[model samples]
Target: MTTFKKSFLILMLPLMAFTAAHKFYLSVTHVGYSEKDDALQITTRLFIDDMEKLLDERYGLKAQLGTDVESKSADEYLEKYFRTKLLFEIDGQPAEYQFLGKKYDTDMLICYFEIPKIGMDKIKSIQIQNEILTDLFDEQQNVVHFKIKEKKKSFVLIKSDTKGMLNL
Candidate 1:
C-alpha cells in the first residue's frame, strides 16, 4: 500500500475501535396466574441506568437507581410510572394491580406487582399494554410473557405497537 494510504488506515482504525455503538433499549416482563393465590403476579426487569435516565427526564427527579445515594421517593415514582405505562385488561374488563416492590440485581431493577382475585378459570382473555421507556427511547422494546395453567404466550412490544393479547 502507498505510505499515505497506510497512514490513513492506521489513524482511522483506532478511532473506529473507540467509537461507541448504539445501545439497545429493552425490558422484560412476566405475567403469571397463580391458582393457589387466585391472582396474577407480574414482574418487570429493566436496566438501572435506563430507568434512572427515565425518572430524571420524565419526573425531573434524580433517581440514582440501585445505588446507595438513591432517592427516597424512587419507589413511589417508579410505581407511578408503571401505573401509567403498563396496563392490563382481563376478560374484557380493566384490571388494576398493586405495585408490590422492587429489588436490584446486578445492573437491572426488578419490579413486582400483583392483581388479586383473578381466578384462572374465569379468564377468557388477557391483554397487556406495555410502554415502558418508549416515551424517551424510540427504539425501546418490551418483551412480555404471559402464563396461565399450561398455556404461555409471548410478545415483543414497541413504540408503534404496544399491546398484546392472549386468549385461552
Candidate 2:
C-alpha cells in the first residue's frame, strides 16, 4: 500500500505542476456550410492569456505585423508579429486574411477576421477538439457555426453550434 501510494504521488507531481503554471480561457471555433455554393468557412477565437505566445508556438513562426521603419520599434514587435502571423487554411490551402479588428474586454481579447471563400466539397468534416483550454470549458463534441455574408464578402463567426465548444 505504501509503495503504491508513493508511486502515484510521484506521477501526479509533474502533472500538477504543469497544470498550475498554465492558465487558459475559453474560446470557440465556428464552421458553417452552404449547400447553394457548396462552400465551407471556419472562424476560430481563442481567449488565451498569451495569444502572441500561443500563435508563435503553434505556427512555429515569428511574424511581423507591419513594416514601418519610422514607426517600427522594439516595443512594437508584438503588433507587427500579430499582423503577419494571423492566418488560416481551408482544404489545405492558405486562406486570404483581412483584419476585421480586435477589442479588449474584461480579461479577454476578441479578434475579428474576414477570410476568402472556400468550397465545401473539399472539407471532410467539422471537428472541435481542445488542446489548450481542456480544463476550463470542454464541450468534447459541439457544433460550430460559420455564417456566410454575401454582401460582406466574408464569413462571420456565428457561435458554438454544439458541445466542448464555448459560445463567445
Q: Which of the numbered candidates is closest to the native, going by highest lDDT? A: 1
Model 1: CA > 4 A from native: 1-19
Candidate 2 lDDT over residue span 43-144, tens digit each: 545543455445456554443322233223422443344445333454444556444555556544555544444554455323233233232244322223
For candidate 1, lDDT tens digit of each residue in 21-134?
878899999999887889999999999999999999999999998888999999999999999999999988999999999999999999999999987786789999999999
Best by TM-score: 1
> What is the alpha-carbon lDDT for the whole of candidate 1?
0.94
Clashes of each: 0, 13
Residue 40 lDDT in model 1? Answer: 93
RMSD of each: 2.7, 11.2
Q: Estimate each model's TM-score.
A: 0.91, 0.35
Lowest-sum lDDT 10-residue window in model 2: 150-159
Q: How far is 20's C-alpha from truth in model 1 (Å)? A: 2.2
Q: After superposition, how far is residue 25 of candidate 1 from its true place, in Å?
A: 0.3
